[model samples]
Target: MALILHDVTFEMVPTEVRLLTAMTPAGFPSPAQDDMEEPIDLASWLIDHPAASYVMRVSGHSMVGAGVADGDMVVVSRAVEARSGDIVVALVHGDRTMKRLRRRGDRMWLVPEAEGLPAIIVDEDVEIWGVVVALARRYRT
Candidate 1:
């Protein structure tokens, strides 16, 4: 599966959303709390460097195993250095793709999360564009 790249632009005004102080549990139900925290700017919370950060939409199932499903939006940050085991947006022969970065000794590779997909050995033609910092998804649109 291939990924499509898109540039994201942020508005001048930040949109604040109310954040609950209580932590929701995934395994069991917790007591309901009425505590309300300060409003949070999602864009600011997700992006560390606004000038070098971009949001791209996932178009394929290659990263589904990594919790990045199709149609999900990922925040990419160019300010951070790409490290081994980090999910990154890469340009392979000028084509953009999203994959996990792996470093074995001096060799680097781009690995897909899905089965049957071959891992790409990083060479001169491949460029690590940015590292995935955050993921956003909506259950209903």
Candidate 2:
């Protein structure tokens, strides 16, 4: 049998945290679909913070090139800033999805990598949920 390995790290910091009001489905605009996902148990899957955090299983093949395939779990950092080349969770027309971010003329656009897909143009109706900080994928036989 072949052994599979992953890197591990540790960081220490203060316990206090600043809070941000979460934007809900009602607040999402220009979404592709209205689907609410079932939340996952964080402790068993990821590192837990004392403050509030949520996890969503990624769906769709739009981000397949980036390795964020359908049913992969992406860890979103609500605390991180969205940069030009970072992957993000966004609400478009009330639909939540994972996408890569890019800057346009004073605006940001969400680009999907799956072939035969059109980019979700971000407008006044779109909201960036959070920046995708980590991704975990499991191989299957």
Candidate 3:
């Protein structure tokens, strides 16, 4: 399962979010105010380097504890160097997998956040695709 990065570029269409001046509490229903701030570009805020970033849909519950849920879209940076404790997409023996990178001395480990799953020890041949920078989720379709 080799995941290849397709050479693709597109115009950045930013989603504008309404900035509220006051914090609305979910526990208590408060009267909505008409106070409006400048619209913020979520694409600019989420992506630091758009040229090096790509989005992919996640699968399975391997990374639930790390805030990455199934069907969530994750922003991955191919140009970013993956470090220890960073969640990354990697090719382990031709199989693409998402896991947290862990390093101890000369050994590397791909750790899963879900319980009952075993961590994988990195072999001699491994290709790290990118580091997961941000996650996007939808509450309702």
Query: Per-residue lDDT for 1-141 in model 1, tens only?
Result: 565656666643688999875655564434575477799988788876888888888887878888898888889999999999999999999989899999977999999898888989999999999999998899996
> Relative to the unseen true structure, what is the C-alpha lDDT of residue 31 in candidate 3, on a scale of 0 to 100?
51
Better of 1 and 3 by lDDT: 1
Q: Can you give the lDDT of residue 13 in candidate 1?
A: 60
Question: In what order do the candidates fall by lDDT, top score first?
Answer: 1, 3, 2
Q: Considering every candidate listed, which one attains the maximal lDDT? A: 1
Clashes of each: 0, 6, 0
Worst 10 residues of 2 by lDDT: 1-10
Q: Model 1 segments beyond 4 Å from truth? A: 24-33
Candidate 1, lDDT over the whole model: 0.85
Cα lDDT, model 1, residue 27: 43
What are the RMSD figures for all models against the true structure?
Answer: 2.6, 17.9, 4.5
TM-score-sorted candidate list, best first: 1, 3, 2
Q: Which ten residues in a row have the lowest lDDT in candidate 3?
A: 1-10
